[model samples]
Target: MNSFFARKYVIQGIFISVAILIIARLFYLQIIDDSYLLSANNNVLRKVIVYPARGVILDRNGEVLVQNEPVYDLIVTPREAKDIDTLLLCNLINIDTVGFRKRMDKARAQSPYRASIFEKQLSSRTYAKLQEHLYKFRGFYVQNRTVRSYPDSMAAQFLGYILEVNDRDIERSKGFYKAGDYIGASGVESSYEELLRGNRGVKNLMVDALNRPKGIFSEGKYDTLAVSGDGLVSSLDKDLQILAERLMKNKIGSVVAIEPSSGEILSFVSSPSYDPNLMVGRERGNNYMKLLNDPHKPMFDRPIQASYPPGSVFKVVAALTAQQAGVIDQHSTFMCPGYYSYGGGRARMRCTHVHGTTSLVHSIEGSCNTYYGHVYARMIDSRGMSGPKAYDLWREGIMKFGIGQKLGIDLPGEKPGLIPTSDFYTKRYGSTKWRSGYNISLSIGQGEMGITPLQMANIMAIVANRGFYYRPHLIKGIGEKKIVKEEFTEKIYAGVDTKYYESVIEGMSRVVNQPGGTGYSVRINGIEMCGKTGTVQNPHGENHAVFFAFAPRENPKIAIAVFVENAGYGGTWAGPIASMLVEKHLKDTITIPKYIQDRIFNANLLPAVKVAAPKAKDAAKVAANTTAGLPKSRIPSTLRINADFSPRVNEDNARVNPLIEFNSQVYE
Candidate 1:
């Protein structure tokens, strides 16, 4: 009887121990660990993301260039979705029933309980119509978002375009970006993306069984407010940009203009361009493919990406280098007997005219090839320095002018262009065999030297500032504080001393003002413009017309570079266009006759042949092929212009008659 009593007491103790353990586990789950509680709350409460509006881009004059337009996205939680009118939902969102099912399956695959996008970028009209019937469809809600809108529909490549993020972009952003988030792909949009995308917020929303938002959960205590992106002020001048684009309407090349003192880009144009609006909305993919397949390559950024031989314009560099090396001075003279004979007289480079006893100023005014040839030879061999050492020094001086290197412009994909080193020549022609005469074509800005229009324009700015320049930039200010970067304000010297620029500037002045000047026909009457003209050789077709200048000569306001492909003489096509740009910028009026303006406007220089459009799957491959493996001096020959046009002159105007003659010559 005592043993039975002891067993009963032990069993009672065991039961008590088991009860205590159960109570402790219940306490831990209910109070210490909140995961289950949070999961339960998620069933009734929906977490919605509030997207902030992207920043608006404005011109220097406060004119809007890019702004945001409201759009909506349809969100769905597949777990809450039940039997509903799928057809009605499809009709409201402008999608078919099959598409709705596909989207629903995708959402379920992602996560049945988590919210996912169903239909993206819905128009306001569709959202308005869908909102009234939203209560009828379970597990679906509308979220507000924004897309970019361009008012002027210009600067397609300058402003760039935005597209939804892919796997790589999402990976790059870490956990910040989802599959449907938009990212800037190029231009100012890309460079300023971090400041322009703004901050996203979240709200805990209470919803009914129908998935309609009833009210803010917990009286909005847990919600965060979205902050809109900071506004950007660009350096672009709206009127100047418009005029530049209009002047280059039918041509195939680029134009870049900058304010000399500040190095702020005023006008940027790449011709054969399309409307920026085509890159927005739901049709972006289709339009992008079409632009990729275009024969003229309107999408290519010619100002920064396309590299070409600088032609005779490079003589400016040769002259500057020779002067800096103490090999030549302003009064230095070289005899030109119509050609420069080099390589022991086996080869010759021809000049346009037999200019006898050409002085420094006269050589530039006449675009004399023989004079620069002799100067370059003296610079390389006559100096005590060896050929390779002198060549390196020459390249170093040219690079100081921002050639053959990326100028660090705020745009993406800027080509550094090509400036071969002494090592490159050593590999090509062996060490001792190659000499100054072997690469004499470089004296006139040819033979393996490549320069982009942006770099060319920067050279003009350096000359205008009398040897120093601020880095060329597009953004004038950022945010409401109007903060400008310090790098853009710092002065960069071009290695050449200030004193040397005067003689070169005087020669450039003569190129526009003097009677025998190559650019005289295109000069403005009241403005004291200094300029240079280049007829760049092309292996595929007609020579490229090139010109660069700074206006009013002293305290120059605007410096510009214009390149027209297959346009023959530089003074004829490029000089006139650049003069018009300068006139419009400084005077706000074009003083040139109406017939001269009409000549540029009416010219059709685009290629006549149409290339076969690549299939969507092969678009990228074809685009790569189109831009690859072409000579640097010209665009792809398949897209070469067939129409050869010359400026039509009015017999009454004697000043304009000089354009009829080809003043600049090219030879090997």
Candidate 2:
């Protein structure tokens, strides 16, 4: 009986011990495991992120142009969100109830714990109402954010728009980013994103039983404060930008002005531009899509993207190259019976007029096409080489001016205009039989030649400085801070010797200050300017008036390029615009004859904005590549005209409105 009782007690003790161990193990799994811990963390401590304020944008003179304004985003977490009043929320926020429901459903599908914003950029009036009724809703809150606003509403292209982080952008940024963060989409914003975005901050909160955030539960031990983006100081002159924009009203064109001594881009204006304020947060997608499809391409950076034949302005480059190569000197003369005849039976290269017995200087001042024809002939023929060899010489001259390749500008999308090379000819004409006569338009900045306004402006900088130019840049400083970049003082040469540049500068000076010069009308009484006129030919049967100039000759300060599409004669349209820009830069006020300013300010070119569709898309790109500086393909017979096309002669421009597509709806 005693043994039996002892065995029963031992078995009971062993069974009890096993049961206790099992309970302890269950407790460990439920309370100590990471999954359980994560669940607990999700329930009580909601993490709210505080985004830093974006930096303010100011002009070179420290005037604020782009700044951040306070806005609110309506945030929610689906698991905790038992929104009691959906209709009121939708009504207050201007979203249809159906749209509100759809958004909420989508948010719920994304993640139960992840917070999603339903309404972006809530108005002050709506925010006040929500703040009053906030306690009525669960897991619904308002988070403070900022939206970009342009107070002055000028310089749209320079101050690119902001956008939400896309999947691609997030992937590129690695794990540091998520959707809904604002990012710089274009212009200065994109380039300065790192400095302007600042650090992401967090506020950790301890909540009570009711899920209300307790005030500073750990006394800020777990909080990381937000830092605002640094302030920016751009190289732009806002007054000048506005003046240029206004001056260019009603015209399709671009104006690029640079400080010759420093490569500071003072004012860059591309017409048919929209106010950047329209591109932020919720409005961004719609506005951008509209701009993306707009016909006039208002979003296009005309200064850097639109390539035109340098036109007569190209003659300046031809003369300079000739002088540099020793093919011609300032004193060298070419007889112009208003034409250059290669095989003389009947094929004289036509000139605008009969300029007889012209020297290099006179040829430049009068823009003698015949003189360049003779010069081209000498470059290719003097070596007793084939047309390809002569084309190579021409290519060398073109390359010297920073044409045919990106000037490597700090600005995005700079298209290097074309300069022909022998390789290009070989590709086009089988390298066996290609002649210079087949591409004579290149002698006058036409045929396959193309250069952007920024390059055109930089060429003026090169001419003004007499040898080299700093890379054209729009940024001067960041947040009252200077970027110690080499570009600020970096010297870029246009491949001309100093003596060659001086000779060319002298003739350019004569063009504006002398009677025979085409741009004499732009000659200001007290100021001296060296100017060149170019009339670019387009297949649309109209010409572009292009002018490049730098002012006050001795200590050249400002260089400018102006382009007026189909406006006729560089002297008539582009020259005056440049003159006004120069005067504005120097005097801070332009006193152009009011009637002329008003007339040009109101001209339009919408009818000719669209060209015939190319048979293939890459054809234009190929053309641009070939013209800007690709080796001359023995270019198969392409379309071209061979004379100086002075535009707007005897044509009325008062009824023109190139700004037909300034608004996104119409343009896109």
Candidate 3:
């Protein structure tokens, strides 16, 4: 009986311990812990997003290219926005009642209890006016933000523009972005987005039942500060870019200038371009649609997108490749009988000027068609190599000069210009049937070759640097830390013998400085400029004019390429413009006569050639119609002669348009 009584006492002690533990837990939960109590009151908490300031963009000279201005986003919670004067609120925001209801309904569709944007990107003046009447409109508030502004009104394509993030952008960003956030859409703004967009922050505050902020929750313990983005220092020369844009105002083409030593683009201009400001604010969508619909394609980035035959400017490559391949040298000589007759008299390639027994230098100076044709044949059919092997070697040499491939510039939408391979010709005309003579047109930078203006400038840069160039880029520096990317710092070699470049350089110098040279008319007084003029054939109308040049023979500064569509001879239009730019950049002032400037500024070719679209169907038809008896290879793809024909005009009525038609079966 005593043992049983002891066991009972032990069980009673365990039960007493459990009862005390339960009482202690209840006191801790009800009296000491308030975390669960706060969570239970969800309507009293509010989360606010703090947007960081976007990065700024400046030119190489530290001139501001892009900046930001303070703006506000008007937000509203539909459920809490009751008992408000709808018409009064509409008048304060400068919107009609219908517009206000539309915005309200749009916001309500997103969420009734949660806050959504009713209006965004309001200017500081508008925000200030709305601030006075905000208290009268319940559940409505203003969120601080910034919008991009271009102070200089230039480099619209390269500087790029920003737009509100779409569903694709937000989904790609995961939790880092929302619908209202802005992101870079194009140009450098899009290329370096990660470095330019900074981290966002958040803050939590206590709110009353009326949706009014009470105070900072937990003494601001959950708040985080926003960090501003990194600034970018671009490689562009603001003054040069402005001048190029001004010069190209009435024309349709592209101009690209670069610092040969650093590969920094001094200027990039595409004519018929729209103002960057047109892409800003509420009218951006409408303006963008208009620009998109325009016939001239103002939004097109032509410097790196539009490709054209290099024309006679390609002779330098032929010369260098000839020397490198051990087929010709500076002293090589060839005779031209005004035309090169090959393929048993079935083929004839004519030269504009008779250049009989010419040296390598004279060939380039006069842009002798026969001379380069012979050299190209020798290079491609030399050293006992087969036609395919020899042609492949020549093409590889050409590619080294940054042709037939994209230069890997920092900008977007760069095209890899075409360089027809031996296989391409062999496939088109079987290996045994095709020979060096079948591809003679390539000697003078014609036929299947197409290169962009950027590539043209880069090729000139390679010549300026004695066969090497940094990949062309727009950005020079990033952030206050002054960091630059490694690719820009690295040097790329053009894979040619340095000794061969001197002769080519000498020939280029004479093209501008010596009399009888194609570019002699464009020579400055004492700049020692080296240049090449190209009169590229356009299937549509008048031939396109092109000029590529670099100044100061020894240590070149600026290397530029200018292209003027349907402008006839290169020296007539392109040469003068390029010379003017070179003179202005080197001397910081133009000493050339005012007559030259006035002529280029007043000249307009768009009206004459506006109706001629670049149609490939017409090219074959024109070729077949114009050269009936000549073999396909013999009939030159581009008639590289001066265009002196005038468009037909009505003699009876001055205002009546003339009708001159070319028969598809015959040329009249």
Best TM-score goes to which candidate? 1
| TM-scores of all predicted structures | 0.86, 0.84, 0.83
Clashes of each: 0, 30, 0
lDDT of 1: 0.84
- The residue pairs in collision within model 1 are none
Per-residue lDDT tens digits for candidate 3, residues 422-481, read 888878765544556776767778777899999999989999999889989999899997
lDDT of each: 0.84, 0.76, 0.81
Best by lDDT: 1
Q: Which ten residues in a row have the lowest lDDT in candidate 3?
A: 659-668
Order of all candidates by TM-score, from best down to worst? 1, 2, 3
Off by over 4 Å in 1: 1-44, 610-664
- Please give the RMSD of candidate 3 to the true structure: 11.0
lDDT of 1 by residue, 346-405 (tens): 656678679999988788777888898898789777767778887888889889989999
| TM-score quality measure for candidate 3 | 0.83
